[model samples]
Target: MRFTLKQLEYFVAAGETGSIARASERIHVSQPSISTAIAQLEKELNVQLFLRHHAQGLSLTPSGRTLFQEAKRLLEQAGGLYAAASQMHEEVHGNLNLGCLTTLAPMILPELTLSFTSAFPKASVSPLIDHQERLLASLRRAEVDIAVTYDLRLSEDVTFQPLVELPVHALVGENHPLARESRTTLKELAALPLVFLDLPHSRDYFLSLFDMDGLTPNIAYRLTQPDVIRTMVANGFGYTLVNTAPRSNVALDGRTLTRVAIDGSHRPMTLGLATLTALRQTKLLEAFVSHAKSIISQGYIPGMMAP
Candidate 1:
């Protein structure tokens, strides 16, 4: 025998509110209608759903408790279905779970999130900050819909759309000698101690910059977090390389760090939006990607200049 979702919903609501009148008010149906629907649902399922007493409004039987759990799940799924249907309209109105590499998260996420929230007021966005490899794994597992990461050696299971070309810059403290240079070469900056982000992929990417110039920079400090590197640099401890300047105002004792140009003819890192090849593109995801691409393309003008 088949049972209707409406019946399960009525039963669950009645169980929750503990009164037919309250359930009717919550579900926007009459108390008699709610009572009849739950009674019919219990009879159809061959279970005693509610234990009714004169003073007490309602309580669930043992079988009723199990049915109530399943009913709640069914109601949640039904709500998701309704939301998906409603999102077919122009405005995006669903949950968007996106992941981003640590490097890009600080530089690019705030603007994208602001614009998305303004445009799709009904939609909710959840951002996951992780390293490149982990984000890629999440995309493969379908845990996240989209990721912003460097367009490196990606598997055939994923598709990458190049969104921005960000020139790598050298981050140095105000007192550091290199901070005063108009344009500096890697060979010149090689003498300074380098603090690495400690990620394999990022280390490879950073090392490749020096390798292209046929030189190796001195390594003194190794860390994974940008803030750690930033703090160290501010104290005149060491210098580090970054894809972009700090997006927000980063201050250390009322002094801001400086991002200087790096010379020696290195290629800009191609930051891309990646999605799974096997997954069907949802409208909300497509819209989000489109907006992101647009913002990245227009926001940062490409040219050779000091930061």
Candidate 2:
């Protein structure tokens, strides 16, 4: 073949990242090398793969977009060959693309990844953390092999294996009137100012709790990061609702926080592993699923408090 797999690898990286510099950083290659590979690939294929803008970066041409998808599939297949060879010796060894919910990442990823890698020393994991919608989108694009996320608004193409159920909790400052309470209701929370999580699908889940009670929350602040939301609640800005509670009640600012269980029956978010239904499960993926099932359950999670 005129073009090499290395060339296709560089081309795919450039297409995904939209710039030589970013692609270089992504795959730990030099910018000049990536640029040269793309140039060579385009010349060999006799196609203009990308549209270069002055200082803006590259966008894929129509042909490049089509080839990019093919290249990704080819790379996955190539990786599977390596995994298959390892499996012959009864070993699981390959790169795993692990996606996680942003809010859950801080609580789960570090420990989960470290332990999984320790158990299977030959295997490696790369984590991609994002909101629910983006994580699912990445799965559809084959950008993420598996995602640890909530069962919220899942599409038919995705398959979720439920691991644990996390009930909602209302976070409040130490001096807040509700802090002393062991449990609070949606009606009680709706009367107070709410520090909304404000992520795409997550926001809908939180709002739906109030909707179920036929009440509207008095949204005092809207924030994205979970830690920031916790800090805001600690500082007495407003109460926020969350399913996964950290082990500590103290915020990043060292202020005290309290997790009050939500009263009455509400839909609890089920934390699980989500994968594309059509994608073939490799040995490495199967190993991870097994490991996850063993560690993550209703009684225990890697880094967060048990439900």
Candidate 3:
């Protein structure tokens, strides 16, 4: 083989990211190194792998797409060989590409990832935080090996292992009229302004709670960032629905907030691990899965309030 695995790895990164600069950021290699590797690989392979677009970035050529698929397969096989060796030694090693829901990441990832790595010092985790749709897409594309997310609109190609149930809560400013209440109904909240967490599947799930009762919330603000939504709620902008309640009742701006359980039974989101159904679970992945199952349970979770 004229080209090395390092060159193939760089080529694959460029193909996936569609830009040498972005690829460099992804793989922690310098842009020049990635560029040189790609140039060397193309020279050895005797093919034009990418069509450069001025200021727009790179795109795979027809042959490049085919080779990209094979390159990804080869990388997976190489990872499998490493996994096999680790299994022989009965040790967990290598990097676990973990995807997490953006809303849950801050509360869950730090504790969860740190503990796992501490337990298995040889294994490290790289986290990608995003919304539901993108997380699922990442699983399909093998961009992430496992995703700690909600079981929301999961496709047939993905498998979800339920970890715990997180029921919906009405988040409000401490001084809000309903804040004193232990629990509230959707009907009562429908009349008031709502600070909506406007993400793909998350938006639908929150709205569905009202839809189930044939009601709609008077949406006052639609925000993407969870902290921003919490701060808005703390400032009495409006109440928002959240599944995972942080350990603290105070928002980032130092304003107090309240978490009131939604009255009656509603569809609680199931927090779980999601992965591609077709992908074989490596020994490292198995170890992480076991650790996750042990830590995340009904009565206890790492960063969030007890369920």
Candidate 4:
């Protein structure tokens, strides 16, 4: 009761983030500052709010869970008052912690600033580009406000809003044997050396495409980064599977890569926005989702297999 609004704000950030360090990074505050705030908050409330898990980061205690809801509601009320006073025709304005899949970051994130931030200039975006598992984990932990990523391995706690369907395509170098072909089958693609973009469920998803055709790809190399895989494929290293349809055939090093349409019964992955189902929707989040939907609808967002 004696704690200030700042304390509650910090507490909520810490609880949602599940890590004082990540909370500090996301909010642009020092770790020690949040630590001090948490201490003060606990002292004033006379209940332990977090359980320190050493290197694994913090987890909310039972008391913390109960208090988190109240803290969030109070913060929303306080924020509404602040926004009301600001006027300027109230629009979504706040620091939104955003997560983009590493592969999609190149295509989606760049447009985010132009489409979303340009409209809501008052909003500040803190973007975290990572893999699928990490993005979903961040959402569940409340580390990220919203995530723009593919629907991969989503748990019950997460909600996925599909923006566009980016189907699986074969990426090959200009000089590759299959490069000249306008379209090819998954079976034909499997025979070539595969520069597999190995990342958790993504690797398996690509393999599943081959399985659909009853053919297993000869995965010659396994790399983590999508750009790296593109570079390798562009340099004639091997063929690879990708959902992101790069607008240009150029790679980082100015190499020309070609995407050949598949002639098989392979399932395509959807690029969507993922968020925690339990979190109360905020104006900032709604604005971002709206902007994203518009981007996809308008064909502004890159990496779409042209319809």
RMSD of each: 14.6, 20.6, 20.2, 19.5
Per lDDT, the best of the predicted structures is 3
For model 1, name the residue pairs that clash: none
Instruction: Determine which window of 10 residues in candidate 1 has minimal summed lDDT.
Output: 298-307
On lDDT, who's better, 3 or 4?
3
Summarize candidate 1's per-residue lDDT along 1-307 as a digit string, tens digits: 5788888888988999998888988989998888889888977888899999776799999999998998999889999998987766656679898898886686677778878878878877899999888988999998999998887668999999987677888888888888787677788778888877787588888888889788898999888887777888877887888876555435445556778887656877887899999989887898898888766763662221223
Instruction: Indicate whether candidate 1 or candidate 3 has the larger lDDT.
Output: 3
Model 2 agreement with the true structure over 220-300: per-residue lDDT tens digits: 999998898888889989898999878877999999998898889999999999999999998899999999999998888
**lDDT measured at residue 102 in model 2 versus the true structure, 0 to 100:** 96
Better of 1 and 3 by TM-score: 3
Order candidates by lDDT, high to low: 3, 2, 4, 1
What's the TM for model 1?
0.67
TM-score of 3: 0.72
| Displacement of the residue 61 alpha carbon in candidate 2, Å | 75
Clashes per prediction?
0, 0, 0, 0
* Local error of candidate 2 at residue 173 (angstroms): 1.0
| Residues 1-307 of candidate 4: C-alpha lDDT, one tens digit per residue | 5899988988899888899989998888899999999999899989999999979999999999999999999999999988888865556898999999998898778777566778998998999999998998899889999999888888888989998777777889999988999999877777889998889889878887777667888999989988888889999999988878867888889999998889866677888889999999988889888888877743545554354
The candidate with the higher lDDT, 2 or 3, is 3
